[model samples]
Target: MTKLVKPVIDQVWLLRWWHRHQAQRLNREADAIRNGLLQDLFAVRRQLELLPGSGGLAAVEHLYQALDALGNRLSSPYLHDSLPLAIQQALADWPPQVPTRAELPSHWPAEPVEHTLLLLAVLNHLGQALAAQPSLPQVCAVSLTAGSDGQRLTIAANYASAVPPALLELDQSEAWRAYLATFDLFSQGRASSAHGATTLRWAFVW
Candidate 1:
């Protein structure tokens, strides 16, 4: 394997907007990204028009400049980084596609243990944040309420602030590992033994 480029701390997916500037480059390379190119362009144009004229326009313009800089620095998510340039070109334009039974790629990414843990940590962090705002209504946890009660809560079991039950069983959570497994990496890799809703709010970065 080539040396893994250390990931930039701040990462953002550009979604369909990036292609507008590279429409021809994308169409010539990744048809999957280009398959519905015209439609996506229209959608982005619509969004730009909807941009508010006051502070929002300036904020969004600045956002584009920042993303352009990030794109120059970071090409893609770490998981997709290792693909051959040919594949990278293909993925650059990967919009959703309909697949014939035989067309699906034999290899695809399954949610790995680490990624799952990270997602859990994020959910846990969000849950805690929502939990703090009583006006937002109680966002309960599946591991807490079994996700069956129709309590009209704001969040889904797909994401919550509690450490996911699936991740809580790791053999020896080295602090942050446990928290990240719950979807809240607020402390990055430092909040080793935190508990309750404040896990992220008071995370120790040491």
Candidate 2:
């Protein structure tokens, strides 16, 4: 009987290879879904828009509005060269009840597309989580700062009663970290809550 042995580097190399393949596959699928599917949906929407008035014209208009909203959500958001403006656009649709305050700098350079997208996703997810909570926070403060090494986003919320459990769970989820790793963007997030107040902060380095 004999046993086979391999260096630890072999395992590391294999993991890296597997991850690379997975990333490539994900990118391909995302591209196909975004471009191919969206194009078809838009074509249908255009046809619906051109239809003459009929018994279902009202229904058709409603369908068109639904399709338009879907298209807006599915399509990529444009990022302006002014990072502050881009961030503001991303937060424009945030929940009004919570009263968010964004402290974004006016002059920072535009971030990488991946960075921009990830920021949007995180913010949107947070907004959804907050909206689902029965008790809304008094205020939600979001601040973006650029240091010599990197940039940071700090989100703090003050709830007059208690911090929502869902927010804590979402903060601990691995999805955000996985997204960062997939995009090869270094990021760190910290969450803390006490006395009906909570803060989550994420910093990114290029």
Candidate 3:
């Protein structure tokens, strides 16, 4: 096994940790804003009701619509309550041709937010790779299984031929190396890609 230098591992770990922390903080802030705006809109609507004027209430309704649309545009719910939902949310932006099929046992354990972020990064990387393929495969399979030790994730690209060049580049890139090191730091995990398949297994130490 090729060992990563301690300093490199620490740097990668810190970067990932900082990213997740900022993302979570931003999500909280956005949620607070959305909630506060909704409350203010409700109060405005109630006040408009007493004015006996349709124009005021209509304008308030327009503001409500705008706020709702803006909330949807912002990626605030970065982490979801369940692994499946998180995975689904991550895959929502992926190319439709390389859609993912996630399999999990009933009531799958919710992973830590950091772990979930890592997993989402991995999935996003794969999605980009698959989208770059010359002839995209129709199905990408992702399965999660749990054992006494921890959780294991298996992703099969199911390419008709050997692994795509785009996918190989992503797997071997320096950026991905840092991400892998961060995963190792958090979960004592290891990742491997063979042919068109990728696997990640890590203990739930956190």
Candidate 4:
């Protein structure tokens, strides 16, 4: 009876040790995952800060040239007579075959040429990002909503399925960095993702 009792006690002790070991290992793994997530978040924020908005002065120069050309055309009596045509010609061209579609205001408020160009760059980059991920759903949806006073812009991208890994990887790529730099003026912005969608919300004094 004494010998049998010793074996039973040993077995219980071994089981308890194994359980504790597994719990510790799981805790370590959870901590590692949390640390990794925090690191990625900080990295993204740093990248955003370093990116040159609108390609810095060079992009500004190009925008000015475009505005100048448009101004010259508008100065002409024939072109000035047709304001709508002039405005349409001055605006940026939309891309072809983007799976994601944008819902913008019926009439975008008049903004400075530089601001318009920046907005166009953001849209172009978003389209390119979606195009790069073939695994994305056939019909992704993008919507841009402006505040009542036009002081803010909310850009949302909703996916029919989970966002592809490749698309998420773009956040660390050089091309994405360059594209983000063009939004330097929009420093006060926040981005978030959940439930197969991502949203960028930006606020400006304007």
Off by over 4 Å in 3: 1-20, 37-80, 196-206
Tell me the TM-score of each prediction against the true structure. 0.18, 0.56, 0.65, 0.42
Q: List ranges where model 2 is wrong by over 4 Å.
A: 1-68, 80-82, 173-206
Better of 2 and 4 by TM-score: 2
Candidate 2 is scored at a TM of: 0.56
> Which is better, 2 or 4, measured by lDDT?
2
**Per-residue lDDT for 1-206 in model 4, tens only?**
45544445565456545644553454344444445543554455456557777245454445545544443332321121332232333222323444444444455444433343344445556656665566644554444456665344444444545556666666557765654553442332433333345432222223
Q: How far is candidate 2 from the true structure (C-alpha RMSD, Å)?
A: 6.6
Compose the digit string of candidate 1's lDDT tens values, residues 108-146: 344332332233333334444433332332222221111
lDDT of 4 at 47: 62
Best by lDDT: 3
Q: Candidate 1 local accuracy as lDDT?
A: 0.33
- Local distance difference test, per candidate? 0.33, 0.59, 0.66, 0.45
- Backbone clashes in model 4, listed as residue pairs: 51-181, 52-181, 53-181, 53-184, 54-182
Model 1: CA > 4 A from native: 1-110, 136-206
Tens digit per residue, CA lDDT, model 2, 1-206: 89888657765456656644553454455455556765665576567667775355566557656654454343233432555665676567777766788898877876644445556666777677677777777788788887775666667776666677776676566874555454342223332322334444444444
lDDT of 3 by residue, 1-206 (tens): 99976555566667767867865665566576578887799888988888864587887898888876565334325455677676667677677777677786667775666667677777777688678767676568777777775677777766555555666666677977776666767655766555524322222222
